[model samples]
Target: MYQGIRIAGFGGQGVISAGILLAQAGVEDKKNASWLPSYGPEMRGGTANCSVVISDGEVYTPIVSAPDTVIIMNEPSLPKFEPLLKKGGLMIINSSLINSRPTRTDITVVCVPCNKIAEELGMDRIANLVALGAFIKKTGAVTLTSVEHAMKKVYKRAKPEMLELNKKALQAGYDAVK
Candidate 1:
């Protein structure tokens, strides 16, 4: 199985981190994976995105021209990446930040109020994780168990409380879509 996923948002939104986690999860599941990140000169609030490719076999290239899935966390990322999605792809959009919706009918769109849901969970910064959770649930490209293991590795140095919070945020996002 091969899945190309793109995660886009403004800087400091954990777009790259989310992509990393996904790739790591793929690795944890013994799948071949690659991650490529891009961003503008401005760090925070600037356009940032990452492409992730996971497959049962080797991934020849990291570039993702047309992704099978895209997680858009902001308004600017919508127009920029929406057109890049493959036909019949899955789009998990953060409706709380992106007011507009995709016009395409060929693809499946799942709108989640990431920021609002994360805020309700008491950590707005985890909005990216929320989107990631939804994406995992919707696509099943990576199992939630694998993501949990990857999260542990990603936050290995962090405090236990923070790790628990992130896990909760992930579960919350997954539940939101279900």
Candidate 2:
């Protein structure tokens, strides 16, 4: 299996971190994966995005010119990345921030109130994980178990409580899809 995914949002939204976690989860699943991040110079509040490629075979390159899935975490990201999704691809939108919907009919769209869900889970920062959870549930690109295991690796400085909170956020997002 192969999935080329792009996750985008303004900085401080954890766009890059989400991509890293996804690639790490792919690694945990024993798959070939790569992650490439890009962000504006302004850092927080600036636009940020990352490309992630996970494959059962070889990962040809890290750059994802056309993604199989695009996770849009903010309003500005929707239009910027929506057109980059390949036909019949999946688009996960953070409905909590984006007020508009995609015009495309060829792709599958799943709208989740990421920020709201995260807030309910006790933190707004984990909204990216919430979107990631929805992505995992919809695409099954990587297992939820693998993602949970990967959290230990990605957030090495995180306390056990924080990790548990993140896991709860993920599970909530996963369950939200259905």
Candidate 3:
């Protein structure tokens, strides 16, 4: 497996949360993991990026200059992060917001209408989870069942009430991909 992953998007697109969940799952599976979130102009109607490292050995860098996978939720992030993904890496793009086609042919692209699915789920925020579910399926880096367990374990401390909704969101995301 590649040593690094990056999830980039807008502020409210849930990039940080998704990164957290992915990192937690990776660590739970006995892999060393690190999550780093960057916020600036990109966070406000611009680009936001989070680096998640999952490695069998100790992680060397928390910042990912080149990512093995990219999850894009907006057009701005598409261009910003497109070049950073390694050749032949997986890219899960939220086509609901990103209208442009990728220029890279080497990377495998999965364009899913995640915002539409989230809206159908009665919320427009779960698009990140949908993209993440597709990521899990394509990479086999983490399982949906394991992610569910991680979510409960992680969110239990801060927002115990979110347990059920997040579960539904993850399941909806997984089902949409299927």
Best by lDDT: 2
lDDT, residue 50, candidate 1: 94
Tens digit per residue, CA lDDT, model 1, 3-75: 9999999899999999999999999999999999987673567779999999998899999999999999989
Point to the candidate with the largest TM-score.
Answer: 2
The TM-score that candidate 3 achieves is 0.90
* Candidate 3 lDDT score relative to the true structure: 0.82
After superposition, the stretches of candidate 2 with alpha carbons farther than 4 Å from their true spots are 42-44
Q: Which RMSD does model 2 reach against the true structure?
A: 1.0
lDDT of each: 0.91, 0.94, 0.82
- Mind giving the per-residue lDDT tens digits that candidate 2 earns over 1-178? 9999999999889999999999999999999999999965736676689999999999989999899999999888888898999999999999999999999999999999999999998899999999999999999999999999999999999999999999999999999998
Q: Tell me how candidate 2 scores on lDDT.
A: 0.94
- Ten contiguous residues with the weakest lDDT in model 2: 39-48
What would the TM-score be for candidate 2 when compared with the true structure? 0.97
Model 1, stretches more than 4 Å misplaced? 42-44
Arrange candidates by TM-score, descending: 2, 1, 3
Q: Model 1 reaches what TM-score against the true structure?
A: 0.96
